[model samples]
Target chain A: MTNTSQDRILEVKTLWHYYGNTPALRGIDLEARRGEFVTLLGPSGSGKSTLLRILAGLELPTDVNVMTLDGQDVSNIPANRRNVSTVFQHYGLFPHLNVRENVEYGLRARKVPAADRRERALKMLEQVQLSDFAERPIARLSGGQKQRVAIARSLVLEPVILLLDEPLGALDEKLRIDMQVELLELQRRLEMTFIYVTHSQEEALTMSDRILLMNDGDIVQTGTPEDMFDRPNSRFSASFMGVENLFDAKVVAVSDAGLTVEVNGASIEGVWTGASLPSVGETICCGFRSERVQIADDSTTSMNSLEGKLTSHIYKGKYLDLTYQTALGPIRMRSWQSHAAPTETARIAWHKDQTILCPKS
Target chain B: MFRPPTHVAPASYMSFVLIWGLVALLPTAGLLLWSTLTMENFQIVWEPSLQAYRDVLSSGRWQVTIRTLEIAAIVTLIEILLAVPFALWLAKGTKSAGVRTVSLALLTIPFFLSLSSRTIVWRGVLGLNGPINAALLQLGIIQEPLDWLLFSQFSVILGLIGPYFPTMVFPLYLAFMLIDDEVLAASKDLGASPAFTFWNVIVPLGLPGLGAGIVFTFVPMIGDPVVPELLGGGNVVVLSASVQSLLRILNYTVASALSVLMLVILVAMISLVAAITARFAKGGL
Candidate 1:
């Protein structure tokens, strides 16, 4: 968390909120500098949506927390009065309003002159490429068009921070991907700080400048996409960041070579990058990506090679998805090309850097 | 929850239509037949005559028809104005199932007791020496008990509204409850005040219920003669009251004519309501 400084557009500290007796956000500390696209990434029930609602002033937060926008404390400001907007997951398009009217709502609320409001709304419509369908009723518009209208509605307001609560979650995977690119482009072009909440880990990795990964009402990690994907600090963080090859390994020793972790009576050394590496005789998790695993040389003296029996190979066009069965567990790898059939001997290796070490949960 | 209909025999469909015809259409035909009959020189006549129609259409009877419609329209308007806000509160204010069920039970208590008893209760409440006058007297709001409170048009309206308002309330509550909380929240989030949201979102959403409630309360108020009989004190003459008085004096032909006229007016008003509802519904209001 950062203080309310000159460059920061929004600052939050020690924010605790509750729904009845249930804690929705516990000790949340976050800051968004000017034009920063921060993502609140978490699974369902992790309170990411709750946090977004509180930030948007839709839900009054319950706590002695400090929240500021542009160096002014706005913790108690009502949603309409606050200089913030939101795009709900369903787009929250008014079914009675046409696309133009929906986009013109905020400006009208702010008492903008009718002529200027109409011109600006039309310009915003053109910006979102919805000018051609401006008069279409919301019920007649497709889902993607509604989404663009929602975006245009908020962008026309030019709020300090736009809180998006999984606005693209309702779209299909293909459309969702396309919208992700469009959203990132819109964010960059407008230079607006967007505090977007979503459970999709890939979306956070692809779109965010800084991702605040949350779990069970607690922020687990906050980092850039690569910082989180490459240097996840815990078992939950590693798996949530899309590293799937986590395994229980007992620490045998730590030395100049690396930390030696014994897995199923096989000693495999891994490079530990975290501060205060685990001591000897402690159990921790070792993880690596499926794409990082390769066929081991089988004769190398490195401490990262393991032999297993091939269970199956799925042809994925660009990559061969192989599952190898070993005494430890199933080790999956996505090789560039198919090697052999299932139920065959296989040896796989990953570099020391790719072999991730995480605390056992 | 519904299974696909494998097949419905044509015989069953024909029976359904036949049953509908027997239940709904036969009575209208009967009314049409009765309205044209003649009462010749104080004796029943089989010949079709326009005398009953002429008697009913006389200027004297027009007063009764207009008064009947006015009272029903007033009651329906008052009920609508009262029921919508009450229904909104009942649906949205309390989330407890027990409270909603108890409130609904309380609303239905007027239905169980006879309409005549309900008129008696209103008489007690609106009478000169009743609780209303007593409270007003004790509060120094009035020096004497109000004279026009009981046995008047006000008492008749009060009597009918007690038993009929729930019909308006229940359906309107269902309509208000159908609006998702998110929709209202979205309206507020879009910079609409609570009053604006109620006018723009809640009223538009509840239009069908408004139409339904109007039909529910209006038809019975216009048709019922008991309330006016007990509360009118011979001062008010509604169409139904006129029809009742006409029938008691062996004016069966005139009575049937008045009844037919009331039925036609009700059907016309209902058609108008249906037209307005259909138009707004099509507009997606």
Candidate 2:
């Protein structure tokens, strides 16, 4: 999101970071408008966390040409000096202090008046719905409560941006869902920039206005969840977003009408889902989500269809996770368990535009 | 523990910890009893009199008591103030354990040598013909060798610092090590300067250990004979030396009373300081 009248809340140009001699983050350029909930989505060691730390000024970047906050340069500022706060994993709530005192820590550090600090801390505690536990020692709070206190503490400082490093990672399944809802609500209400770091694809998809997928210290793709899952730009992005069926195919022809690709010996016509179609004879990775394919009777199946023997199938409540041995390779698909009986030759079909084609990883 | 550690037997370990204390403390209890007894006229009779207590109170042993308190208070204060920062550096400055071990070993090298040898070394270092005087003379920083460096209150204070400084460091280092680095980093992230972090986080967190160090240094220093006897060299007469000299002349009654009084005062002073520290900490940071 951008506005002509307002400057970017945070802007980074050509950022690089290294741990010792090994590069943790390769050159990265990024800009965030005010109130954008950007998710840094990647697996472990993918440099997502490192990038977030650099943005928060917790770690110094190896080199940065333009690191600014609200159009002001903040390259040399420390974490304490920068107008950003973080809700670190494990909560990082000071155990020796009560909830109220812990919430007021930043205010106290800035030498805010005693009365103002206490009143503000109380107000923040109430906002997090922990007013009753203001005087309670942090050790006594439950995991979810601790997380809320941490969020409240970070927000009370009124930072320009808040970085959350898997804040709900420690919670149980039920609590995580609840916190996810609460956090998204908070992010919307606060109207401040948020850089959320998480490896959970579901979390990244659910909360992010835009997801920046990272791999091997490089950002692979940046798009909305729909764009990522439906039409990924790279094989890494496609597979990382949970594509179960991938096949190597050579393009036979490309036109405005559609593109045809030859897989093994079968020519499959599929609408080109990517922005630019591939040239004839070029090899590309064809990926499809398991749930996107449709299994049909061989007699009525149309284009983008393949005939294969059913290898195996797994009953997974709402859908049957089935694999078929086709001429190209074994391809997996999610079929409703009620329609599938284990032993039969089957025809699997999908729409022309459902094929996600990308360059090889 | 998820699984109990097999090697340690709580029964045996607890007895070793508790039984030794009992065995050591029986003598003090006996001394307290003996302090109330006196030999009447020429007869060896069990007659409890306030005479020895009165003599202890009247013979100006209170001066020795006050002097012992002054020295203990000064030594404990300086040792803690110095040791906490050094211990913090050892525990947090570097991630390497080897550095801490080597530094601690170097700090306590004086303890490896006998106390007498260490005291003798201090004497040499601070003496008129000592290395310090020679260096100063050679550099022409002073025309005369400093006389008060050795055999003065200064020497007593200086002498106790080196040997007892480690006592403060050991406990404080343990406490600081117990603090999670995340907690400290979080403090700094929340805009606390280093000094504020130390006061608001490190001090309260490390207080119990520091309080123990204070006991370790102060309790012993209050009645310490070696420092006042050897290093002080008659320029200072602390309570311990007073107790020793009283015994030398067969003044057993007065000696016993003096020892008991010093013990009581030391315990009371330690308790008072502990109470103050506890109150000031307000449970924790």
Candidate 3:
């Protein structure tokens, strides 16, 4: 195995890939430093997985734009030449081979000496805690065990970086959670760069150092999970970040007092900081995270409190999601540890910063 | 919860199976008992004779068995080496779907062609003034028509190879199809080239069918009388034809004994083949 030089592991520039004229990835620019866990998060058909395939050299971009690893141009390099390993949604374990042979397969392909391959493969089997089942068949292992074996098989080469394409998507919910934690722990222990691709928001939020939010074959936004969640830059981002209270409104006026927007017979005002302030009668929409909106308290300070009837409530262990029918239309809010006035109408308010503004088309 | 009625009652199934089993066993059981017992007309019937068995061992019947086995072994080896590559190509190569369908049709055409018609065609094709000789002569590849093309071991083998290629190819193809493309991609992503992937990943997965195909083609070739009868002429008398001669001469006892001997040899060959295949097919779940 080669030593990991502390250099940029991969850099993709303006990558555009297409499938028979249908755009799969458009103008994707990304860079992975030597050892970072970057997860590509998006909905289905968001080009996240396509981007991973491009980076792994399994796919070629429509244009031969520069893609480099450790400063070496590898845009057209075959997957075998790149020292990157990928774990697929299906484990793709060779059904015919036992665990030990499957793990040793890559080493043999690399033309490692027989003695070295055995040594390295046995060590890898031990690392994945499958030493006891080294001789056991791959098909006999449970889902989690098969995935671990797949990881061990890929990791045996000590790959420069590992690409995981929805590796935990096939597992049940409890197992998926367990695997997420396990994978994060493994990545931390190995200190190897992991480029994970998934469409699950919770998965991205749970385990990404930084997430690339992709939409419609492009990277819509890229930020740390907290940044993307707490301050999503657009309506799409807000929705993707699990912000539920998004509404279309028109800006009625902006003054030193504050900015006011008229919506559904209710006028809501908040401090505005958007670069392009909407003119009067200009259509705009705003969003807020369900948790950011709360039941009005006596100590709270806000000029934007709305009197709304409590329409529906669903209790979660930590928080209850409440639907409030105010004059501004139904607004969803999340409350922690308590429910207020579910029987009839109530007032809900939030700080100015909690409100997000976006241009409405 | 209501239970569904069992259509095949256990008693009926057992009785059915036992009847078929007895039907199959009766002839073999009869042969075994006849081979062991003294006949009422001892001189004419059984004669309590181990003589046929002795004749089998002494009259170069053992040599014929060896020759039959050797020829089948060589044929199986050659068939596998040639057929496997084509099978793999047919199964995994990026040929157009129409081409694949057509080529598969070509492989299967010989199976439906009458055996007698195929042999007659081979005779003409391989004849001295046949198309092959004429083509070779016109191309200046040969000065004389090759008389050795017909009525030889080579011709018999050519005949065997023609009919048996599909048998060999079909199983290997099925096995190759069973290999998941993800597994192939995973191997590639793990830094294996196409060649390495085929040997380490594809071949192991496809072995059981490869083994099965070899067994299917080999076992029958050992006892096939037609190939030798039409193509071997007087130059070759494989074991099956020799057994036929015994039957023709009204040596039913000897023919039966010869068939039983052939059966024993076939069982041994099958077991050997099974053992080899079982070694590779383990853990293929």
Global lDDT of each model? 0.83, 0.84, 0.81
Encode model 3's per-residue lDDT on A125-225: one tens digit a residue: 89878889988888799999999999999999988889999999999999999999999999989989899999898999899988999999988878888
Give candidate 1 misplaced runs (Cα > 4 Å).
A1-4, A254-258, A271-276, A298-303, A311-321, A338-343, B1-19, B29-38, B42-54, B57-60, B137-143, B233-235, B250-253, B275-285
For model 1 the local lDDT of residue B118 reads: 71
Q: What is the lDDT of residue A296 in candidate 2?
A: 64
Instruction: Count clashes in each candidate, considering only residues at least 3 apart in sequence or on different chains.
Output: 0, 0, 0
Better of 2 and 3 by DockQ: 3
For all candidates, state DockQ relative to the true structure.
0.41, 0.53, 0.56
Q: Could you arrange the candidates by lDDT from highest to lowest? A: 2, 1, 3
Provide i-RMS per model in Å: 2.4, 1.6, 2.0
Candidate 1 per-residue C-alpha lDDT over A148-259 given as tens digits, one digit per residue, 9 for 90 to 100: 9988988888888888989998999899999999999999999989999999889999999999999988898899999888988788988888887888889998887678
- Candidate chain B TM-scores, in order: 0.89, 0.86, 0.85
Once fitted onto the true fold, the runs of candidate 2 whose alpha carbons sit more than 4 angstroms away are: A5-7, A247-283, A298-303, A307-320, A336-341, B1-21, B40-45, B104-111, B280-285
Candidate 1 reference-contact recovery: 0.29
- Per-residue accuracy of model 3 over B1-285 as CA lDDT, tens digit each: 644446667897788789987998777766654444332322336446766677777887678778778778878888999988898888788547887899889887777878777877788889888999999999999999998899887888888887778889889989987888788888888888988887777877888888889888998888888877898786778999888776676665656666777777777878887787777677432
